[model samples]
Target: MKIVKEALAGTLESSDLMVRVAPSPEGALDVVINSEVMRQFGAQIEKVVRETLERLSVTEGLIVIEDKGALDCAIRARVQTAILRAVENPVLEWSALS
Candidate 1:
């Protein structure tokens, strides 16, 4: 339930989000979010990303996303990016784009 280095480095607004990418027993991801977006968006962010992940066929691990005002699209992108980045790759050498 920790994001580690998943976000765009400094782009992470708050530490409210927690993303986990463990291997799924169903050979797919299981995404779950502790969302409070309803107060902000008048809707639940979980259904948003859950549907998106299912539509995108992201079936792997129990992704527990803690939300704090991140939009649906942003949530999806961040989660997907985190998962992809978690996969095989060399050490990502990044510099400030600011």
Candidate 2:
């Protein structure tokens, strides 16, 4: 899905995370992540984000992840939510998300 505009999901509260997505002017995916557990889970968080984006066929966007010790599932959900919000006339295919 293409990011047509800026969108946000989730929150910065503990055990939760915030995802921000916007169109990339450079036509490339740019991801930034900040997490309370970065020392131990930073790579995992980045991997989850990248895999989620790939599954959604996201090619170009600026994604920012703010994590407060959220689980991988939460990260995926937040990213999916933000992507849906950022797309125009989004048509979600539930099976594809699996």
Candidate 3:
């Protein structure tokens, strides 16, 4: 899924995470994450984000995640929502997402 425009999901509230996705002309996946538990769970969070992107077939974009102690499932949901919003297309392959 190509990010055609900027999109955001989630909030800054506790136990939630905010994700921002945007298009990138550079043809690379650029991810920036800010989390309170970066020291211990940063790598794991990055891995989750990468895997989510791969699952959605998102190869090139800029992703910024602001985590407020969110679990892995929440992070994945927010990322998926943000990507869907970024694409702005109603005809999504829902089966592929499963």
Which candidate ranks first by lDDT, i.e. highest?
A: 2
Tell me the TM-score of each prediction against the true structure: 0.54, 0.97, 0.92
Question: Which pairs of residues clash in candidate 3, taking residues 3 or more apart in a chain or in different chains?
Answer: none
The whole-model lDDT of each prediction reads: 0.52, 0.95, 0.92
Candidate 2 lDDT by residue in tens digits, 25-67: 9999999999999999999999999999999999899999999
Score residue 90 of candidate 1 by CA lDDT: 28
Over 58-87, each residue of candidate 1 has an lDDT whose tens digit, in order, gives: 555656666666765666666665555545
Candidate 2 positional error at 35, Å: 0.5
Best of the two (1, 2) by TM-score: 2
Q: What TM-score does prediction 3 earn?
A: 0.92
Residue 70 alpha-carbon offset, candidate 3, angstroms = 0.3
Model 1 weakest lDDT span, ten residues long = 1-10
Q: Candidate 1 — which pairs collide?
A: 28-59, 28-60, 29-59, 29-60
For model 2, state the Cα shift of residue 2 in Å.
0.6
Least accurate stretch of 10 residues (summed lDDT) in model 3? 88-97
The number of clashing residue pairs in model 2 is: 0
What stretches of model 3 exceed 4 Å from their correct place?
90-95
> Residue 38 lDDT in model 3?
94
Which 10 consecutive positions of candidate 2 have the poorest summed lDDT?
89-98
RMSD of each: 7.3, 0.7, 1.3
